[model samples]
Target: MSIQLRPTRPADIPFVYETEHAAENRPFLLPWTEERHRQALAHPDIRHLIVEETETGRAVGYVIIAGLTNPHGSIELMRITISAKGKGYGRQVLRQVKRWAFEEQQAHRLWLDVKEANQRALNLYLSEGFVIEGKLRECLKTGERYESLLILSMLSSEYRD
Candidate 1:
């Protein structure tokens, strides 16, 4: 299914909250509070977007990107959670983000960090040309144990489209 990303509306916060904290997605991500999501909408350097199906116009996921106007020309893919899986929506949205960051925003680098256990997301980033930069070993402390996050990035010259 094809997807289009649009600037998120205030009404979409609940959907974003629900999707991020849902059992299927919660463990892999650090859940943000509703107010935090609300704050992101007004943050000058952040882009909080909703992913909607082009055919149905329903919100299936959301993406949080930061450093829109960084002096270093580097942007971070803060978070991306697609509730509707198994339809290639994640790849489509990621490609769109890459185009927007490199072509439109003129970003020199686009980067993100993914939990080591999230092999699915890691594979997608690697396939899309993001090189693994480093790993923040045992960085995030969960309830009992720590979790590591692998940092990955792609430069403007490396983007295919």
Candidate 2:
């Protein structure tokens, strides 16, 4: 199925909320409140996008791009969540994001951090041309414990397109 990214609407918040807190996805991400999603939607610097299956118009995933409003030419891929995994959707979404960040946004650098144990996602990022810059140790609190994250990034000079 063909996938598309669209500007997230207010109505999409419920789905975003549910997806972020979904049992499978929760471990890899920090929990976000509905109000936080709302705030992101309202922020000029942030881009909250809904990833949809074009043919069925079903919302399958979401991605958040932050730090766009700055003049530093750097953008942080704050979050990416695919409700349905292992179907190659995440790869397609990452390709689209790279295109948008480099070709459209004209960004110099695009970066993201992934949980160290998320081998699937780490592999995906590596395959997508992101280089592991470093590791942030015990930087995020998941609940009762803190976890380390691997910082990965791609620069415009290194973008294939």
Candidate 3:
């Protein structure tokens, strides 16, 4: 849970794309193309970051945050994809992201939507202090199947640590 977040470079896109498309992550979130990742890298309102091991400097995952320009101080936790699951890296990354969004970015609220079936991530989010807001019933069609998402958020005033 002590991973480091570094600014993502062009070369990082392949890993990011691959991670997004990984079988472990594919069911939980939508996958983006390499070109889309590249475009996001150049977007002012977006922050594309690589999550690495603190001591080894090995990249384990990536995170995307958006709405930096939101006048209302609300930010989106766009995506988080860790190549390996059950390693506590996701929680580490979530904690880091909370600090960045609330303390560094001065965001009043940070929110994310997760697939309803992603119980692991949903449990993580709830345990980390994000409150359930609502549910988007069948909002996305990944393939022949439709998926619903649960929206969760945390207010800056509710932040801890």
Error of 2 at 107 (Å): 0.7
TM of each candidate vs. truth: 0.98, 0.96, 0.96
Candidate 3 segments exceeding 4 Å error: none
lDDT tens readout by residue for model 2, 57-84: 9999999999888699999999999998
| Model 3: per-residue Cα lDDT over 1-161, one tens digit each | 46999999999998998899888888887788899899999999999999999988889999999999999999999998999678899999999999988889889999999999999899999999999999999989877988999999999999953
| Candidate 3 steric clashes | 0
Tell me how far the alpha carbon of residue 45 in candidate 3 is from the true structure, in angstroms, after superposition: 0.3
Q: lDDT winner among the candidates?
A: 1
- After superposition on all C-alphas, the RMSD of every candidate to the true structure, in Å, is 0.9, 1.1, 1.3
Clashes of each: 0, 0, 0
Ten-residue region with minimum lDDT total, candidate 2: 138-147
Highest TM-score: give the candidate number: 1
| lDDT score for residue 36 of model 1 | 95
**What is the Cα-based lDDT of residue 153 in candidate 3?**
96
The superposed Cα distance between candidate 3 and the true structure at residue 136, in angstroms, equals: 0.7
RMSD (CA, angstroms), candidate 1 = 0.9
